[model samples]
Target: MRLATVADMPRIGTLMRVSGAELFPRFYTERQAASAAIYLTEPDITLIKDGTYFVYEAGGEIVACGGWSKRNKLYTGSGSQQDDGRLLDPATEPARVRAMFVRADWTRRGLAKAILDACVKAAREEGFRSLSLMATLPGVPLYHAFGFQETRQTMVPLPDGVQLEGVEMTYELSQ
Candidate 1:
């Protein structure tokens, strides 16, 4: 697999949007789904284009993506609240990994793990102390395998008063 760039966002977004179950919760909620879809569909959900975004591409297809948002204001403090890497210290928090996604077809193939490792390594290389992610309902297990643990749960308000349940997770580096 090869790493992707800003150009791969649309394809990556489409991948998750297509795998509705893996993305939009099985329980249908228009507001929740719409809000989640809108944010994740963007290339910078993890603020990659404006910072560090990583994608896993195989056979010329973008199968997975994750980003290490360096700036706190990327998505109105999203990069700050969920990214524990930043909580450690500003100087040590250049990159906060977020919005990790692997195609449904690519599941159990180690793409998620690979993409996660890449994001962590990128953050550490940039001198970040830890990496953070807001684990989606289906993404918790993957993050756990990479030494991330739940730090908090955040509820994202949607248009119809529904909420998207997300767990804020963090992976601290040995440094």
Candidate 2:
């Protein structure tokens, strides 16, 4: 398992398991829009620029990945990169865990946890005290197991006007 650079974005973009348009409204219960967030392609650019991505693998195959954004000097809003609610304190680095998924063949293994551990370690090393993520329904328990608490429910408002229901979660990485 290792970290992925934006060079790995195309591959990671392909590996991400999407729930499909109907599934979004089915599982978390969201309203429809012109497009869907079923895949990472919708917001690929922002996901790349906003954060660094980590990839998990076995035998050189990319299995899972998630992105962590370090707080930047500027704040645009919740919908873009460099948006940290406009805080300038470096230690207050806010992060986002985006596009995390394990290959279908790799499920039930501890690989997800391992990848998650790496993300947390990197966040801490980057001087961040906390990290946030939008948990997919099936991934909620996994995040909780790693000490992430539910903060609120959210929606990733796609540029195409589609919004996917997500659980807003926060993880405190320090004492």
Candidate 3:
């Protein structure tokens, strides 16, 4: 895995789109799935800029992408909430795990876990004791296997007026 650069956005976008298109429909309506693939899969430039986002490649193609953020944006494509861009205090707030996606053919290949491992290590290096993410229904099993506990159910409003169901989950880093 390597830190994602602006130059990598196109491939990353492709990965996200294919991943969401193939994965979300298993657990959501066709419209909701399509809306999710459209809205939720947007690349978070801030993660790339902050040097937190990462992509895994095989044969010159990006196969997976994900990141952790010290900023307050829990997820992306939400159209700027009040506290969206603020930096979080590592002492008091969990680092945000944002924008995780994998190529459709790359599922069950440990890619997301590899990214999550990197995120955990990176966040620990920066003094964050925990990490949090809003996991799409299709992603909940993976997050659960990674030791994240569900805190609540979430309904994210997409740009197309569709509400996507997700789970709020948190993971505590071992000291």
**Highest lDDT against the true fold, candidate:** 3
Cα lDDT for residue 102, candidate 1 = 73
CA shift of 134, model 2, Å: 1.9
List, residue by residue over 125-152, the lDDT tens digit for candidate 3.
Answer: 9999999999999889999999999999
Better of 1 and 2 by lDDT: 1
> Worst ten-residue run, lDDT, model 3?
76-85
The number of clashing residue pairs in each candidate reads 1, 0, 0
RMSD of each candidate relative to the true structure: 4.3, 4.4, 1.1
Give lDDT: candidate 2, residue 115. 70
> After TM-score superposition, what is the CA distance of residue 48 in candidate 1 from its true location, in Å?
4.2
Predicted candidate 2 versus true structure: per-residue lDDT over 1-175, tens digit per residue = 6656667766775666342332333455444422443433232444455455667767777766665656442111235554443433436556666556666567668777877787788778877788877775657878888889999987756555666566878889873
TM-scores, in order shown? 0.76, 0.72, 0.96
Model 2 alpha-carbon miss at residue 104, Å: 2.6
Off by over 4 Å in 3: none
Report how far residue 127 has shifted in candidate 1, in Å: 0.9
The C-alpha stretches of model 1 lying farther than 4 A from their native spots are 20-22, 27-31, 45-51, 73-94, 159-161
- Clashing residue pairs in candidate 1 (N, C-alpha, C atoms within 3 angstroms): 44-47
**CA error at residue 113 for candidate 3, angstroms:** 0.7
- Give lDDT tens digits, candidate 1, residues 1-175: 4555566767867765665445565533666666666554445543544556667777877777666666653232233355433433546553456666677777898877777777777667767877666666677777777788899978755444556787778778773
